[model samples]
Target: MPLWLMILLGTIFGGLIFFAIFMFVRSRKKSKEALGASAGETSKYAGQAPPEPEVLAGQVAAIREHDAAFDEGRFLKWAEETFFKVQESWTERQASGARALMTDACFADHERRIGELLAKNEKNELDALAVSGTAIMGIESDKQTDTITVRFNAQCADYTVNAETGEVVRGNKAVGAWVEDWVFMRARPDYLAGGGEMPAGGLETNWRLARIDEVMG
Candidate 1:
């Protein structure tokens, strides 16, 4: 390879590696930083109220038309459970355990993250991880799918450890709280009823997380 070409290739490869590490660190324990909490702060949002569900009134009504069983209270309960379930899987690096609870794209992203951690011989530790509150912050629907954005108030002491040496490579072990938005989606019956293409499954498909987004304080 030409010298300049080699240098360019090396730079690109190095950038990708850095990006992967950056994303992994952000996902694992940067919630406080993302939420603008200082190092001495505990859980900044521990006493915070979840967004009012009233904002999603219209979206809930629309979703109920497709599946009358849709209930805000019930869904919030399930979402809170899901927050714990997914966090357990993430900390354990067992993407398979969360496959059914996430959309294909979401699953793929998590699976790849797990693979990368394994390759690097690192693990994210989430001790005392807990969700204090969960609520439907917003919802939207189309002929294809009904999507809900859930806001979660959670706290955890997250750190990355070396798998073999068991040394904490990053993050403080202090428990900190942060708020985040998790988006879940379910296929609409009409989309399947029409036999048209969709991002995921058809009739009787359960709600699955499509994505997770950081909520800035």
Candidate 2:
């Protein structure tokens, strides 16, 4: 080979070798950086261990059992606590008010309208029977970003009072049946019944939806 040709070939080969070494070193550096970053991530996660798989299963099972029991029980305890607790005093007050506010014929006519089919039993101590009923309630499950709708049945016991004497007549239990539908909207939170006003007293009373936003529904 000529002298110039030999020099040129030597330079080209040397350049190629240098380029290959540079590439190898660059790749190794990059791989080390990546591995270090990955190790950091792994260490961070390692500090917080995952929950046991059996724990999740147990929680799910408990929730299922609670739901089943609530369904079977018809949420009677919830109803009694919510309904009677709020209305017990009001109902008794209304019973006392009825004597001064209503006349015998008016009361009798009201009873006939209700299909109670009662005869004039006695005067001084006339017994009255309010009844138990099914109450419709809506419960909600809340999260940071959303809410879920939950529905359950509840039963409220009936309230009774003496018609003429305005005394609570608990000798015989009084019960009624009520079925209602409730709707839940995500945007409203301050719903009320009877337009947020106090409920009026009556026999076998029906609960009216005044402000639905207040309800959990």
Whole-model lDDT values for every prediction:
0.71, 0.30
Write down the worst ten-residue block by lDDT for model 2.
34-43
* TM-score top scorer: 1
- Per-residue CA lDDT of model 1 for 1-217, tens digit only, reads 8999999999999999999877666655553332210112332323445545564677778788878888998998998888778877877877788888887777777788778778889888777877787777677887777778777778878777899998987775777676777877887767777896765432235788777766632
TM-scores vs. true structure, each candidate = 0.73, 0.21
Q: Output the lDDT of residue 138, model 1.
A: 72
- Candidate 1 segments exceeding 4 Å error: 1-54, 198-204
**Looking at candidate 1, what is the lDDT of residue 149?**
76
